[model samples]
Target: MTAISETSAQMALRDPDVRVMLRVRADEPGAFAELVGQYQHRLVAVMHHLIGDATEAEDLAQEAFLRVYRARKKYRPRSKFSTWLFTIANNLARNSLRSRQRKPVTPFVSSESGSMGPHEQMVKDNRSGPMQKVQRKELADLIQEALAALNERQRVAVVLNKFEDMNYAEIAEVMGLTTKGVKSLLSRARMNLRAALAGYVYMDGAPAPEEESERPV
Candidate 1:
């Protein structure tokens, strides 16, 4: 085998998801469904964060899966399966956002009903009374707004880093950026999110004092 194929083989050996995808490539029954079941919620959540519309996010997620299925025959284990999947999702999100820019419509207003991000979990763990529930809902709304305020690339980087828990190298692979570029991108995203959420809450779900200015402006 060629050196690249050897590397691919090594990667496939290292990642079980890649092996599953290889099964998909081989037309193994149920492999594609297994892949979808494993990733559907995550893919949809990432898409929702990217696009800001739950329905559109579902559509994009489905499209991403469709593309993955159609391109299974060309699958190569050059990177982690999740990274490759999100790369496709990122492309679709960018295209959808660009199209929306050309023909603006009323923005979709989605509640944080089914969200299970860090902040949501924090709130869930702390829910003690109706007042706390109200606070949790407000915090969730503020967080969503803060996320929406970020520019597209920054939002993508932040979502991949914070939500997906992807390391810099993985994010770089998914985003088609150098590692340094991913670092810089995440730095800017952090600054933007801090600025957007200043005096409200920290990214770690800690409440920020009204007078706190420790976070970079």
Candidate 2:
């Protein structure tokens, strides 16, 4: 392994999550569980957006944590633990998608439980309209379709940028892309999403307003 620089090591030590990871590396009690508690929901949400399925997303997120725990012995904090974790997640999601493409696709199974699943949860979180004020379920389905229509890399970049609130650099790190490439990927994704959902969903001809990040590329 390459030696970590003193400054880099210090920066890693300063990160709260990195400190927790260090504890995990040392086999400290509760450290891995703490990491899971901190990131489980976020990873599930991100995976849901990537794969368009709640159950699979939950499974994939759990698998990510399992991999993290397995790798704890080799843990090295070069970046925030969240970044490293999501890099694993992003790779897994891509592989899952690719594996799906190679197999005969199965019919989608809707949840039997009465609780709102990830698709509804996502719409309720992102879209501004009250559920009672609109055809919320139908609209949610449309938005989910729009998001799913994006190519895998575009969908990943868009979800990381829009949902995870990751800036271009952070997204680039997770995706193994340059910041400029992330910007362009997201730009194309936004355009594709807009076109796919236009007239059918967002009738105003304006893109859904997203929180602006300062472009670093």
Compared with the true structure, all predictions reach lDDT values of: 0.82, 0.79
Candidate 1 clashes between residue pairs 3 or more apart in a chain or in different chains: none
- Give the C-alpha miss distance for residue 156 in model 1, angstroms: 0.4
Scanning candidate 2 in windows of ten residues, the lowest lDDT window is 208-217
Candidate 2 stretches greater than 4 Å from native: 1-9, 106-134, 200-217
Identify the candidate with maximal lDDT: 1
lDDT of 2 by residue, 40-116 (tens): 98999999988877889999999999999899999888887778999999999999999999998742333331366
| Candidate 1, 75-120: lDDT as tens digits | 8888789999999999999999999989976444344544554345
RMSD, one per candidate, in order: 7.1, 8.3
Query: Judged by TM-score, which candidate is best?
Result: 1
